[model samples]
Target: MKAVLGPFVPSYTGPWLAGVDEVGRGPLAGDVVAAAVILAPDRPIEGLNDSKQLTEKRRELLFEEIQGSAAAWCIARASVAEIDRLNILQASLLAMTRAVQGLARAPEHVLVDGNRLPQWEYSAEAVVKGDSRHPAISAASILAKVARDREMVAFDEQYPGYGFAGHKGYPTKTHLAALEKLGVTPIHRTSYAPVRERIEQIELF
Candidate 1:
């Protein structure tokens, strides 16, 4: 993991290099939440890699450490309705922009995951596997993922049959089966394929 963090070492790079990442993009329900994290150059963290590579316990531990260590950090979300309105790509961009804008100190440079950059005024770079390569991006990934998971767990309590705690709103087979049995809920993305198909079937019936 140290080797992964080497290239992104902040040494005199600027006041900050904010790394941004989002979670819940592919979920059939729930908001897309993005996190922007600015790590202090002098105090780099160890065991920082892509969030998906870590266990849930490890991610929770890192989430606390990041909250304490970061110079500026924030998470923002675009709701399911917004995702339907803007499409996932644009909604994710909106969520990222909100996360960056919410930061107490504006970053000199923005490092984002994936190929496309957001329309923010700040100078930015998009790395294909940034969450694995960049420390700040990895940290943001953990924050966003952990935060979204917690929200899904809570939703599971409210909507008992959906199994949100298990699949976290993704289109797993169990989730698809549940949709077929229970039908659409308010939290579901009406624009998504699975939900749309179910709606059409009901309409035809």
Candidate 2:
């Protein structure tokens, strides 16, 4: 791993550097949500780590704190229709791009949490597992995860029996069984293999 200057490190780059991350790539339903966060020099948030590594309660706490502390932050998403039209990977990237663009102020540079940088105009760098390595990216990851999870929970209410609240729209056994029983919903990503197969099966029968 290469060293970088971030708030987590002593050689802090100014808050102009925004960190970007996205969630919901593997979900069979809902949108791919992304977030960009710029942590100010004055606010140094602790417990900044990968969202996946934290408990749901911890992530929820961090999500709110990050919003309150960050100099600027934005959350954006590519809708289910957009996910079907554009591939998931592309849609995820597009969500991240939109997040950065939607920030309160444009960043001088961006540190993306994945290995692949989005098709973006701003100066950017991709850090593998950056959510764990960079505080700002971790903040973005927490925000994105919390936001998407809330959406899935809400979708569970709207589209009952799919267990969106529990599985968060992942291709879990419960979700697959629900799809088999309840059929696909409007939020389901028809482009995904599992969802597509179910759709094909439904069409045949």
Candidate 3:
């Protein structure tokens, strides 16, 4: 038999391959959301890039395009309660796993946009900064970010002074100050240091 060599190819470029990415991991409130997308080889979407690199308006536009063009796509989340119980990292992985499993059909391979892969049965690879490099991952990133941002905007109406609309549940100075002055809301992650400190202070009184 003759030895043969072939050029390496990224699995995400293959059929039935999914790219996964998450958003809202650093936020002090709201769930960590993840999205999985299996892009159609024939239907190439233009301007796919890291969701953070794009404006909100651009992401919104791409979000629709991805949904309409992808062969399979799903968005899933780990709640604040899950984050507190399992820790943020584990919860994020869980969210990603859920997103992959939620696809209309199982992916032959999964490319995750981070250094770690979730513990799951699917064949997967972890690609650092994959969102910028892979179209599927970028699509996933846009979906996760837009979904989570919209949720936080809705939370702003319910929580009022916390500025969830502006900060999107991140631990901004305004958010920290609101936590101290207005007290921790139910959406706030109690496992986080700032929220835990507030809870302790309330317990002492």
By lDDT, the best candidate is 3
Off by over 4 Å in 1: 1-12
lDDT of candidate 3 over 120-175, digit per residue (tens): 99998988788887888899999999999999999999999999999999999999
TM-score of each: 0.93, 0.93, 0.94
Give the alpha-carbon lDDT of every model: 0.91, 0.91, 0.93
> What is the lDDT for 183 in model 1?
93
Show the lowest summed lDDT stretch of 10 residues, model 2. Answer: 3-12
Model 3 residue runs over 4 Å out of place are 1-12
Deviation (Å) of 23 in candidate 2? 0.3
Q: List the residue pairs that clash in candidate 2.
A: none
Candidate 2 lDDT, tens digit per residue, 1-205? 9766444441337669899999999999999999999999798999999899999999999999999999999999999999999999889999999999999999988999877988768888888778888888999999999999999999989999999999999999999999999999999999999889998998897
The per-prediction CA RMSD against the true structure, in angstroms, equals 3.1, 3.0, 5.7
Whole-model lDDT, model 3 = 0.93
Task: Enumerate residue pairs that collide in model 3.
Answer: none
Error of 3 at 144 (Å): 0.1
Q: Could you tell me how far off, in angstroms, the CA of residue 81 lies in candidate 1 after the best superposition?
A: 0.5
Question: Which sections of candidate 2 miss by over 4 Å?
Answer: 1-12
- Model 1 has an lDDT value of 0.91
